[model samples]
Each structure stands twice: as C-alpha cells, then as structure tokens.
Target chain A: MAAVPELLLDPAIKIWVLLPISIVMVLVGILRNNVTTLFLSPKRTVPNVRLLKEQQHLGLLRTYRRNHHVFISQSDFDEKFDLFKKEYEFDNLMRHYVADPEKLQKLKENPNDFNTVMSDLSSGDMMMQMLKGNLANYIPQTVIMYWVNFFYKNYIVMKLPFNLTNNFKSMLQSSMNMIDLDASYVSAISWYFVNLMGLSSIYALVLNDNEMVTQITQQTTQQQQPAPPTAGGPTVDQLFNSELEGFKITDIKSCFTTIHDRVLEKYQ
Target chain B: MPIVNPSPRQPIVIIMSSNKKYLLNQYKTSQYLNLSPPNLLQLFNSCKVFLATTNKLSPLERQSILELYFYLSILTNHDIEAKSTLQKLKESLPLTSKSEKLAVLESYYLEAIGSTNTSSSTSQEKKDAKQVSSSKKQETILKELEEYLTQVQTLIVNDENKSRAMSLTSQQAGPLSRMTTNDLRTIVKRKVALHKSFSSIDTYVNQLIDFLQVNTMDPFTWNELGQTYHKLGELTKAHSCFMEIAVLQPLNYKNWLQLADLEVELFYSGDLVAFNVLNDSILHYLRAVELCEVLVDAWIGLVVALKLIPVSEMEKSGVNSKLKPLEDLKGKYDQLLKLAAKKVNKFVELGLVTDDKKLNSVKAVLDDTK
Candidate 1:
C-alpha cells in the first residue's frame, strides 16, 4: 500500500542525454534502411506469366465448379464438370510439370505425393537476399547498442508518461541495477530499443517507401508459402491438383426446379 | 439595339461542372458519355490539374492519372500529349506483367496515330484521314494491330523460354512468364475491337474461341463472343455463351435480362420448341426482376413472356400457375400487365438519367397490350 516515489531527475538530462539518444536512434534506423536498400538487389523478379495463366485458369475452374450448380441445368453442369475433371486429371496436368525427369520419376513412384515433391525446391538467390537482410538488421542494431552502453551506461534517459507494471522492469531497465527506481525511468540502451521498435510511424511520415514494405512482405510470404515451382511458391501442377480436389467435392443443385414457384410468388 | 445583360447563371454552371472532382464523379457515373466531346474536354482539363499536382500524389495515383490523361488525349486527338503520357507510363511502371499492358497501350497509341509503318508514322498523311476511304484506314490499322500482336507474341515466347529455363535450374518458379491472363484477355479484346465486317467478325470469333480454349473461365470474352453471335443471328450459340455468363455471375440482373431478351428472340424466330423456350424466358425475366425490381426492361419482358405463354401451358403442371385455373391465371396476367404499365410510367416520370424515351415507348407497348 506504499505510494510510488517520483525521482527528481536533472533537467540537463532532457537536453543532452535523452534527446541525443532518441535522435541518434532515429537517424541510425533511417540510415540502416537506406544502406539496406543500396546493398540489396533492385531487380524484383517478374512473376511467371505461364504460372499466372495456370493459376487463373484453376481459379476459373474452381468458381465454375462451385457456382454452376445454382443456375445451370444438371446435364450442362455434369458435362462441364466431366470436361474439367478430364482436362485437369493428374496425367494431363503432369505434362506441364513432368517435363523434368526427376518429377516424372517422383510421380511414377507416388501419384499423390504433391507436397513431398515440392518440399525440395529452393532458390539460391532468395536465400542470399534473406541472409543479406538479416545482416543489415543485426549489424546496425549491435552497433547502436554498443554505442549507447559504452557512453551512457547506468543513466536513466527518460521518464515515460504512462505507467507500466514491474513486469517490464527487466526490459526497460536493462543496464542499471537500481532496486528502487520506478519502472517508467527508461535506460539509454532501452531507449534505443524503444526508438528502433517504435519509429515505424516516423518512417511512414518521412519515407513513402513501398519498396521497404514489399521487401518485408516478400520475406514473410517466402517464409509462409512453400517454395514456388519457378521462384519461391508452390508449383502449377500442385495448384491445379488442389483445385481438382475442390472440383471432386462440389455438389450440384440446379435452379430450374424452383423457378416456376418463384416467378408466381413474385408476380402475386 | 438592346444591350444584353451578362447572365449570372453562365459562369456558375461552368464552374460547377468544371470542378475536378465533379467532372470525375460525372464521368464515373455516366461512363457512356466518356467519348463525347464536351465531357472529354472537361475531363481532360481536370486531368491536367491532376497532372500539375502530380508531385504531391502517391505513385499509384500518379500512374493512374497519367493513364487517364493518355486515353483522354488519344480520344481527343491530342497526339503529342498522348505519346508523352504513354512514355511516362512505360517509365514509371515496373517491367513485369504490366509490360504487356504497356504494349497494349502502345498499340492503342499506334491505332490512334493511324500509322501504317511498324514503327512510328513518318508519313505526311497523318492528318488527312478524311481524304482516304474509311475501309482503307481500318485495313491499315488492322495490319498494324497484327504486326504489334506478332511482336508481343515473340516477346512472350522469349520470356516464357527464359522463365522455363530458370524454373528448371532452380526449383522455384521464375518471375517472368510468357503471357499472363490479363495479357491474353487484352490482346484478344484488341482483336475483337478491330473488326467490323462479317468475314472479319467470323475470324475474330474463331480467335476468341481459341483464346477461350486456353482460358475457359473468362466471362468478358464469353459475353463478347455471345454479343457477336447475336449480331450474326446465330441464336443458339449466343444462347450458350450467355448461359455461361449467367452461370458465372448469377446475381447480375443485366446478365439475366440479356438471357431473357435472347430467349424471347429465339422464341420469336420459331426454330426451337416453343413451350420450353417460353418457360425459360419467363424464368429469366422473373430472375432479373427479383434481382432488381426497378428494372423497367425486366418488367416489360415479363409482360411479353406472360402474353406469349399459351393458356394450356399456363394450366400445365410444370408452369407457374399449376394449382390455379386458366381464368385466374389470365386475370393475374392482366393485373401484371397493368402493374408493368404503371411501373414504366412511374420510371418515366422519375426522369432518372436512363433512356426515359425508351421507357415511354415500353409503356405504350404495355398500355396497348393491357
């Protein structure tokens, strides 16, 4: 039930210590972004149009298979479904992907192993770019951390306006071992960490850099999806196969049966 | 002589319509007037304002504004601005599938310039299009379009090979593909746009069929093919194409209306079994009316369909009035006819920007029948 004591910090700390640390952190982060852009390859790989074509066709087939039953006659729906099923059969679609001898062997060994077949795919260039990005992120962070620690060690650089619980004490007060300091008094090194994490709004204001955003999204997407057949995602055959599975499960319910009553009710 | 007083309304009207946002909104609302001279000139003026404030806009906005400016200048026959805007689009857009779009735009620019040469027009006859026969000009444009099509094909083929090679070496797919879906759609559409004669339309129809073979699900191309077939009076083929679109976009009232109109046409042609065709037309009209009750065309079509259906068919088990007697059905049809007439008059009175004169004619038809 004891009231938390407020520290009367020196006024000069605001001018010399806190501002310099925050400003330097912001400048360093921006510099890192620019340096990363300069060092990285500007050549964004063009998406394979053939793969795009295949994907679009698959999408069309999917929508058709899913929606056709609602409006089309049963005979018409069945006719189209059979045609799509035949065209997208494993044997027919394999021609697009099985031009490779290894894929042919893999298909021969196991007809349904689409996942395992694509698991081995990787791009050396993509790997190198990821490594470069990690290095760019880490080196500047380490340099800033060292600079702040060596110069402004044991110094409380900021008193945060909002109260944080003692749970954040370990994180917000990393360098100092003061037992009685309030959790709001942020250390110089922790201030650098805060600016590094928190300056995205500042970046949005200062830099209209779509390239940076796309690069991050590309990295994340690369991590999320399976490596593509040509670049960094799934193969065309794999996509077609999944869509065929979708086709197999689709149920048809024609609209003709109820049209008579619907018309009469609307008129009535 | 009476001195004319300058009207206060004159400048206000100009200022109101000439406002950039107002013009853009007007253009968006009434897109059919896009090629009209006054609208084009006003849009071009507003587009110039956007072009001046280009630096403050985002890259995507700037690119779209430039594209709009390019099309407007081409339509307005401002050849220099058109070329410069296209050049800016080429430079600003990344070299990807967008390149195919740029190629299409370049072909559009070529068509506008009316250059016979594969390269830019170096001829002295650039402005003398009126002197030549219109057919000859179209022939030259088609030839130029074909040349550009071949050039794009080669580019796509080469790009495809490169990506194929890259994919083989690396397990990942390459960024470059030959021709994208958008590329194919635009190219086929360009071909479709060029033809006017019967023989050429047949050829274009064949080309569209081939394109559809590769892309089995494109509704736009299917609709284009259907419209072309309808023009050719090949009613069955047009029916099938419109059927495909109806299946694809079931909720679109316009598609239902189109199908209903085609069915009515087929019924009038007296080729197919009349009973089922009338039934289908009635269903389609009902569907269109269900989607959009205010659709004047659907209401008129419904009235026509009801009049066409035989009394025996109306009393039949599968028709709408299965339980009701023929007299009741007849009475209902009369009421429906009156309702259609009332709706048509109401819509005509509302004077919405739709074809009010057409609605009046439709109303007259409904009144005559009633």
Candidate 2:
C-alpha cells in the first residue's frame, strides 16, 4: 500500500520532465535539418566572367559564319572584331560600359552596324549579370545548394543521442516527414531545370537566326554593284521601239490564228 | 407599199440578203408600217411574198433569208406564225444542207420561248393560244404528208408495198407517246449535272421513280436518288433509299460506308442525337471491322468513338468491373499486332525494309507497354 504512492509519483514526474525534453529534442532536430539545408548545401555559383567569355567566343564564331567574305578582308574584320572584343571585356568588368572613345570611333565609322552589334553584346552581358545576382535564378545552382545544406545540417550536425528506445521511434517519425519534404523539393527542382533549359535553347535559336540574317545582308551588299546607263537612250525604250515590237504584234496574231485553225480543223 | 424608215430596218435587210432588198426598202418607206400591229403584219407579209418569189438564191442564202423572217416574227411576239414559217423553210431545204444551221436556230427559238414564258405569267390565255397555234402547225404538217402519200400512191408500181410503206411511215410519224423511265432518269441526271438546278431535278426524279416503280431498284439509280434526297435534307427518304441499297447488296462495302457517312453527317447536322446516331455508326463500323479486321479506317472510327466517352464516366458505369470484355478486346489487339509482326517478319525475311521503320515504331510502343 505504501509503495503504490511512490510508483504513481515516479511515473508522473517522468511524464512531466521527459515530455518537454522529448518535444525540445524533436523540434531541435527539425530546426537543425532546416538550418543544414540553408547553409551547408552544395551550391553552383555561376562565374559571370566565364559566361561572358564563352558568349563572346560564340558571338565571334556567329559573326564569322555570317560574313565569311568579311574574314577574307582579314585586317578590316579583325580590327573591328578586336574593337568589339575590348568593348565586351570592359562591359564585363564594369557591369556596364559607358560610351567610350573606342566605342564612339566604331560607331562613327559604321553607325548602323555598330548599333546592332552593341545591342546584342549588352543584352548578353545583362543576362550574365542577372544570373550572378541571384543563384536561385539558375536551377543547377539552387539544387546543389539545397542538397548540400540538407546533408550537412541533418546527417552531420544532428548526432545527439537519446535513450535507444525513444530515439529509434523519433527517427522513424522524422524520416516520414523527410520523405514528403524530399519529394516536394525534387519536383520543384526538376520543373525549374526543365523550364530553364527550354528558355535557354530558345534564346540560342533566336541569336542564331539573327546572326544568319546579318551575314546574308552583308554578303549581298558585297556581291552587288550599280549598273551604268548604256549607249542607247535607255534599254527599256530601245526594247519598246525596236523592230522586235512589230514582229511581236505579228507573232501574237499568228499564234492566235494558228491555235484557232488547229481547233477548227480538229473539230470540223 | 410605202417605205417607213431606212436606218432602223437596215439590219433586217442585211440579214435577209439582196433578193429581198426591194421588199424591205418598200416596207421601210411604207406609210402604214408603224401605224398598228395589223399594219406591221401587212408590211411583213408583203416582204414574205417578195422573199418567196426570189428563185435565184442559193440554199444557204435562202436559209439566211428565212432565218431573218423568223427573227422578225420573234421580235414582234408573233412566235406561233414565226415557228410555222421556219418549219416550212426547214422542210423545203435539203435536210443535210440546213441541218446544222437549223439546229442552232431551233435552240435559239426554244430559249426565246422559254424566256417569254418565264417573263409573264399573267396571261394563261396567251399560253393556251400558243399551244393551239403549235397544234395547228402540227396538223398542217400531217395534212401535207397525207397529200404527198396520195400523190405517191398514183405513181406506185406495187400498190400493196406502197400501202405497207405508207402505214409504216404513218406509225413512225405518230407520237411515240412517252420515253422509258430509264431514259427520263438519264436526261434528269444530265440536266442536274449541267444546270445543277434542284428545282427541276426534284420533279424529274420523282416522275422517274413513279413511272419506273420496281424497275428503279437499280442500285446506281437508288444511290443517286439517295444523294439527291440527302442534298435536299429529306433524311427519311434518303435513309430509306440507302437502306434499300443495304438490303439489295448486303455485301457491298460502299453501300455500308455511305450509310455510315450519312449517319455521321445527320448526327452533326442535329437531325440525330450525338449518342444514338454515333452508336449506330460505331455498330456499323464494328460490323465492317468484323467483315474485314484489317480495315484500318473502321478501326480508326472505333478508336475515335471510344475515346469520346470519358474513362471516368466509363468507370462510374461499372465498365471497369466488367472490363473482361475490354481486356478481351485488348488481347485481340495484341494478337493482331503479333500477327502483323509475323507478317512483317515474312517481308523482312525477303529483305523488304520499306515497312521496317513503321514496324520498328510499333514494336517500340509494344515494348514500352510490356
């Protein structure tokens, strides 16, 4: 009878103490998992400078493909290409380039051509800047960062021990929560990656088409020459007033009569 | 006769030729020519008298002159008298010499008469009068033939043979009554094709069917009638005709195909419900498929109809519970694919790569499902 009160009190104290402790442990485990996801995730940091370099290389190749004849006049094209390359490099370093003396010289020499070239260069530069400004804007960056943080924080940091029985049960419950979290993240990341790839491919296609049109225009201008007036009053008037005109009239009438005669002879 | 005017009648003189030149010149100068219809008729009669006396004219020249006379009669609304005079001129000319010209003139005459009849429906009396006048001309031709026969009788070396020939000629000359319904139907079809006028076609088709009765059971004729009925939106009649074809030629794929097409068309036009009408087509196609399972078109139709009924609704209808039938169908499709593969294997064994790409694609889909 005396031992019954002790037993009751002992169980009550354990419930009061362990319940709060267990709640704290579970909450801390969740917080640790989230923190790891945030900080220690393997993130892809896009090198803006590297992207700019690659874009510049592609732009040069496109320009060459478009105006292959321009490459035949190597000195002129190379000088222009060098100027464009310098402008791009400056833009990369400065985040944006103001109209510099070299750029002004290029513009003055071929104002229309230079304007289009500069516009394309600036657009590519701006895109790179935006990518660098937010890692999440690029899918691979976000995915890598998410997984790295998740692995580091939850598995590595949250190594706390509890009584084996309780700890096993808590781990099981947390793992269920983890499955849902992992599914959602995977779905989002996959969607983002697919969309980003599609958009980038479309951008590439447009750029390719632009380069093709520019090259065609340049080649046509090179091949074409103005015609000089002939010795006659004009070729048009000569053609209209020549003996051929009289011959044509007779020819037309003859043609009609021949057809008429053939049809009549056949039917008759 | 006095000359009335010169310039207005110049065209008529040129058309009639130089032999009638004096008569036309007199008519142009005539004082009574423009006075009234009777006075105009008198002047024209004087011209005709002069034309009849002109003997030096060639046969072509005579035709040209007589054509002018008929033209004047038509312009003056004296069509009955014009037609009689033209018929007389036609008979007097050697048949071969004027046949082509006469055919042209007859077509013009018929067109003119048709236009005149259409223009004024006010006077039934005028129409009746024209009919009576035509009948009189026919009677006059018959009387001339009788006189000619009597004249021939006087010269006959064999009287019985002459009488027999006269009887045969008379029988040929009498009205042949009506054409066979088949001929009428052919004429109707030609007219429908040429004029594309349903107004005449409907009447002609009905006349042919009524006249021909059971003789009109020819599938081609029924098919044509069904098409015409369908065009007119007389679905019941069209259906009956099509059904008759189906009954008459149960094995004819074309008849079944047309019926299926009509059912779909009727369903689309709101003449039939989507469900009921489409099911009828589906059933027909199923029958067609049963007859020829290699019928890709029928299979396509079945696939389309089945696709239209939502899978969720099918499930709700206990279709899923009873999917043994569907499973059996799926198994059949699979078996068919296997058979197709075997057939392709035979072709492949002979080194035919033309169908290899398609077979490979089908094989891919099969493999993916498996």
Per-residue lDDT of candidate 2, residues B104-202 (tens digit): 345345444543233354587556656766546434433433333333323332332233222211111111111122222332233232222223567
| Whole-model lDDT values for every prediction | 0.65, 0.41
Best by DockQ: 1
Poorly placed runs, candidate 1 (over 4 Å): A1-49, A65-76, A86-268, B1-56, B87-98, B116-140, B149-199, B313-335, B348-364
For model 2, the local distance difference test gives 0.41
What's the count of clashing pairs in each model shown? 15, 17
Candidate 1 lDDT score at position A20: 88
DockQ of each: 0.12, 0.00
Docking class of 1: incorrect
**Model 2 lDDT per residue over A156-193, tens place:** 11112332333343332332334322221222223222
- What is each model's TM-score for chain A? 0.63, 0.17
lDDT for each residue of candidate 1 in B206-241, tens digit (9 for 90 to 100):
878877765667787799899889999999999989
